[model samples]
Target: MGGYCGYLATVGGLAAGADAAYIYEEPFDIRDLQSNVKHLTEKMKTSIQRGLVLRNENCSENYTTDFIYQLYSEEGKGVFDCRKNVLGHMQQGGAPSPFDRNFGTKIAAKAMQWISKKLKEFYREGHVFANSEDSACLLGMRRRALVFQPVIQLKDETDFVHRIPKEQWWLRLRPLMKILAKYKTSYDVSDSGQLEHIRVSSPW
Candidate 1:
């Protein structure tokens, strides 16, 4: 039931050891700060049972990307199947954009500075600050500047949302993503539809 938030969940899920993840983004971005790594784990292991398709056999469940795409299509009937759908608004996978790379450098530098400052303060106080919930903080970019805030101050202090907010802002589009599935292949009138078709229609 989320857009970019759903996508980033896949990203974080992949980093946390998922074989493959699908990120669906589309119009009307929304932000749901509640999703986190623990929620992801719970999603994978829950009361609902999922079919595990074996080689040379088809299952009733839709686990593949194609099936998910169908779920995204107009016929999907608002199936929040995976709470994952629609990636028209998702970032294309590739090398980092120059802006993102540069932003990363700045963010890393700021975080390092914060860490160093905290270490110095700890040394002065003769105490080690290792994973203290009260001392824990989230680093982010705001107004083009890196800022640090204590985790206690945020309703969500999860590692995912606290550090990266891209998906959060796009969460609202999750519903539209499912609906986009209807328009997926209905419009292919462009000369560049050959490549653009795949690019726009499929969220892969």
Candidate 2:
């Protein structure tokens, strides 16, 4: 979730009243800035405490097309004893399994319900929101029900729009994706939809 999906997640998380969004900090590693490669001292840790660090002037993960972000690294946080996990290919390209199907159905149903409710409210209030800024309401989950969120607290714009907020819980898990990405066979081992047979030594 480091690209467009990441952006949407950040905006959605903010709209949903999150304290802060977890984005990759600048200078993920000091070695990225070196003209010639030196011995890499900053090693990847297993815990959130040691895995992330503070953003430095040399970090490149802080940039976004639409919004500026204040990113922090897992190393800088000094929270060691990190644990990492991934759901892998099934999440990206595999067929939808039972849990995925069920969860998707539930979320989709709630989204439709929110849109219906929005149109009904708009009709009754005689307010029409045609612009993206006004109509782009953030949808969120409140308890078991799907709720609406506004980024800028534009009460007037809420007259018409349905939007689902981002999943911050998942957003927080994004860093692990990068850490484990080194081991994923999909990155360099797989080419032309065929997986290579040789064993990979180090992705880095």
Candidate 3:
């Protein structure tokens, strides 16, 4: 869940009743694999101690669930039961919520309207509609409004290497989400002068 629209996916995980959601906001590096696994396992230890179900969303392109599951299991000393469910070829497939259904309908309606207008103008001009920002735009909801953005501009804003948008609006909600989930993150300096994160139980 830490790739592409990971923030939104993290929200969906929370909505699905996960006790805690771990979102990977940064890109995964092979050099940091060991440290990353240790870090995640340490975080999961806190959730396990509190008897909470945890869900981690990471970029599949960088690492697979197997890597995390296997490493986490080894770190857990066979005490924690780790399970993995693979939904092949399903893009978050499940029963659509009312809000999602409504949003889809609205988007479709608006898209058809826009296409119809373009078709009418094209016929009126008796010439092919040139590919421009107006002709090639993505209609999406941004901040509760249906905004259209040029594909060219979006391409420029994309992290081509990662194949995700460079700027994600939902990232701002990461801290708030963690706070609401009762995830208290505390930091401390070890004897080796290394920084370490220690999870503290939330009062609320």
Candidate with the greatest TM-score versus the true structure: 3
lDDT of each: 0.42, 0.38, 0.59
All candidates: TM-score: 0.36, 0.32, 0.64
Give each prediction's root-mean-square deviation over alpha carbons. Answer: 15.6, 16.6, 6.9
**Residue-pair clashes per candidate:** 14, 25, 2
The all-Cα superposition gives candidate 3 an RMSD in Å to the true structure of 6.9
Candidate order by decreasing lDDT: 3, 1, 2
Tell me the spans in candidate 2 whose CA falls farther than 4 Å from its real position. Answer: 4-23, 30-91, 124-135, 141-146, 151-204
lDDT of 3: 0.59
Ranking by TM-score: 3, 1, 2
Model 2 Cα lDDT, one tens digit per residue, 64-132: 311121212233234223232222233355677897798778878877887786676556456755444
| Candidate 1 backbone overlaps, count | 14
Off by over 4 Å in 1: 1-4, 8-94, 125-134, 142-144, 155-167, 172-204
In terms of lDDT, which candidate is strongest?
Answer: 3
After TM-score superposition, the amount by which residue 121's alpha carbon in candidate 3 deviates from its true location, in angstroms, is 2.6
lDDT of 3 by residue, 1-204 (tens): 334447655666556534444445545455445543444455555744422333344454446668656755675564455566654446566899999899999999999998888777666456766555688889998888998787887987888876677776655544444455444454454554444555666444
Query: How well is each residue in 1-204 modelled by candidate 1, as lDDT tens digits?
Result: 232235454334334444223343321111211122223334345553321111111211234446534433433233223343344435366788899899889888888888887787666466775655645888876676787887776645344532334325433433332233222222232442221222235332
